[model samples]
Target: MTRTAPHPRTAVVACATYLPSTLRTTAETEERLRVENPTLTLPTGLIRRITGVENVHVAGPEAQASDLAVAAARRALEQSPGEVDLLIFASGSQDLIEPATSHIVSERLGTRCAVFDVKNACNSMLNGMQVADALLAAGQYRRALIVTGEVPSYAVRWRVDSREQFLRSFGGYTMSDGGAAVILEAGEAESPEPSGGRGILGSRFLARSEHWGVGTIPAGGTVNPHSEGGAYFDMDGAALQAAFASVGVGLVAETLASIGYGVDDLDFVALHQVARPYHDRIVEVLGVDPERTLLTVAEHGNLASATLPFQLAEARAAGRVGPGGLVALVGLAAGISLGAMVIRL
Candidate 1:
């Protein structure tokens, strides 16, 4: 059944995900941390205990962020073959700073489509969708591809200096390598038949940029490009939790309400998750039905921007969500951004 809307709309037609072949169990991750710093007396099982992260993907040294993106993009296009007018590489990790990673992805994929990069931490992919949707709505592009390759594992802190340093680097323990791709195409304009809407119905975003300091990979930028100190993940878990607490839980609910929907009306929800505790807290506060949301932190760790699309891809595969089903892509980013994008598939 096709949607019969009065105007053209950007529809998410395909979704796919990929993970690196190398897998590191929580035990191995902890052991590596301790081995690298023999003086480290940090407690064991802390990652599994606190984050429920049993395993995370680790890319080989030869693998690049663009490789992951291309892999996922290939899978998505294979699922729904077509030419793309634009490509957006929405990811936290890049192959290099000289050129946008999208260029690398396009070149690898053998596509010369207009390409660029969009970055906003874990919200990168969502923001890319927002941009694609806007452009499609304005008839500026016929179709766009949004892809992400998150390699937070590469920036993980392997050597713990002290308990305080471990606390600051705790977030890195749950880091994983992941890739995802989404295809967005403008639906045909206007039909008079009874309609069930398709594509992005509504989306809302709110950010407290001041929280940017709460989490960072302090190196490779102007501030610490030449220093080893800037090469690993640095985050204050307490500060990030406090920052999100200050933002409250109204964003998703209010966004849905504005679009005339309630939490129960959603068929499936994909919440950006970094850890089990944070995921549980968000689920409880939002009053979302735990059974209906995709919970992945325990298994895949933090997939970063790929989390939402990875969930979406899994839901579709499992029959939890499908064509004509209503779904919500809710995101919580490190820069303290909260958002929800409602879609009728």
Candidate 2:
């Protein structure tokens, strides 16, 4: 016997993004590297050709991850239909190790609501949304604020000894500073169908624990504090690519299928902003129309978890997506986790 689907109870009412004012252009980055390492030689236009990132925003010295998160959250609150009953700070970067950064954001926003943090590297915001959705669906909350601030600029190591070191630092160069927030609220389900309304239709997450070491920050944690060669971001690009090739495409297909939809049913798709090649490959694998998916890596670089919401806000502002559209939010995190959330909006 066929079973009826559960009605969607949470709808994204508003979304906003904040980008730092400081700009770091590819030309400046290359010039600085050349000056520091005179023997270094990179092919002309290689950075732009490979990453497609012309510039990335850098947070000022005074700006912390929580600051950006608060900025974005305030903007979202301004546009929200109702007051926030809960706040979730989801970011890879945190201003402090204790007290949870969400508390700081709530204090800044003057929100007396319950607050907490959810982190999954680049997938933090998506995971936060999933939590909010579940809470709303369970009638535990009426309104929730999901926010992220990614200030990876602080982790970048500008000086490298050799080409291998430089290559290892490439991921840092592609990271930008930014924040994003989305307000989700409980709303009446659409008549006759759950997926017909402006709410999350479904979400799925998959993890490959063995690949957890693919991306990492080698220093600052309790396990390896003050260790040498552990101050900056490092990644295994080849391994990450292989993981995506082997399972990424299949995961996305499975997610869409679970929601009773396919890539073609998506009016817009927002994926993590890694680089040009990864973006292209994801679009190809999903069989999605390139024009329907938004690409911000070229301009904003990788904002970590903030990338998805930033792209969603930008797409809404550009009139590329609107009411009643079906959108898909996809994420690939450093923990070697993959997730997809289908939303009807």
Candidate 3:
């Protein structure tokens, strides 16, 4: 017996992104690091400048995360400009370990909606979309707002040798300080068919726990114990590349298949920005249209969990994504985790 697919009930209303005003050049990063650790030899240059810092000028980790989140949420709200029913904050990292970041943003935004945080490494934004869709489908809310913010600079490990090794730590350069927000609303359509609102068609996620350590903050976790030493991100570059080629590629193919659409069917694809090499590999593996693949890693680097949604906003603003178009948002990160979804418009 065959089964019928569930209908899409929620569609994205409006979306926007926030990028800090400050800029930190590659030379500046090197100079700043030289003061603390003179042995640093940077990669081809992937560092970016962020705003909201003190006399130091460059944005500190926590400040970058918060500022980006606030700015992006504001932009999204302005785009939609309505009373939001719910607010969800998604991020791989946050401004603080205590006091949920969503609550902080909610208070600042003057929003009285339900507030919370969603996290799953880099796939947090996509996961939040799934949750928002579920709530809207169930009629729990009429409209919901999703916000994602990332500050990779804080977790970056800067003291490494070799340009090859430096390039390995290049996730720092792909690190962007930004945030994104999108408004999700209950579709007016009675059936599952796509409409002007462009309801969510479907989504799939795959994560390999055994490979969670492929990329991680080594000293901060419970087992590693931050008390053992100062905590920092420790990436097994070799392992990550291997996983990207094997598990990462397989997951994208599988999810796209589940949704009954191949990469070619997507009008546009917005993926998590890690490094150009990784992007190239995924594009090659998926066999997607090069023109439709949007990238911001060069300018903004990887904004952790915020990458996908931020890209969505850019594509929408440029008129690359719109009503009746099919878009796929893909996010791949540390857990060897992958997320993808096919949405109409």
lDDT of 3 by residue, 179-274 (tens): 788889987654433322367877777777888876776554568654364445667677887876677455566666765667777889988766
TM-score of 1: 0.95
List model 2 lDDT by residue over 1-345, tens digit each: 665664755888899999998899988878887888788887766788888988999999988999999889888878875678899999999888788999999998888899999988998999999999999888888999999998999888778888888887788888999999999988776644535567888788988878888788877678676657756888877787787667755777787787577888888999886898889988887898999998889987888999999988999999999988889999988878888898887
What lDDT would each prediction earn against the true structure?
0.88, 0.86, 0.72
Alpha-carbon shift of residue 236 in model 3 (angstroms): 0.9
How close to the true structure is residue 173 of candidate 3, measured as C-alpha lDDT? Answer: 39
TM-scores vs. true structure, each candidate: 0.95, 0.95, 0.85
Where model 2 places Cα greater than 4 Å from the true spot, the runs are 1-6, 191-194, 226-230
RMSD of each candidate relative to the true structure = 3.0, 1.8, 4.7
Question: Of the candidates shown, which would achieve the greatest lDDT relative to the real structure?
Answer: 1
Q: Order the candidates by lDDT, highest first.
A: 1, 2, 3
**Per-candidate clash tally:** 1, 2, 5
Q: What digit string (tens of lDDT, one per residue) describes model 1 on residues 191-261?
A: 33322368887888999999999999888888887856658888999999999989987888877887678
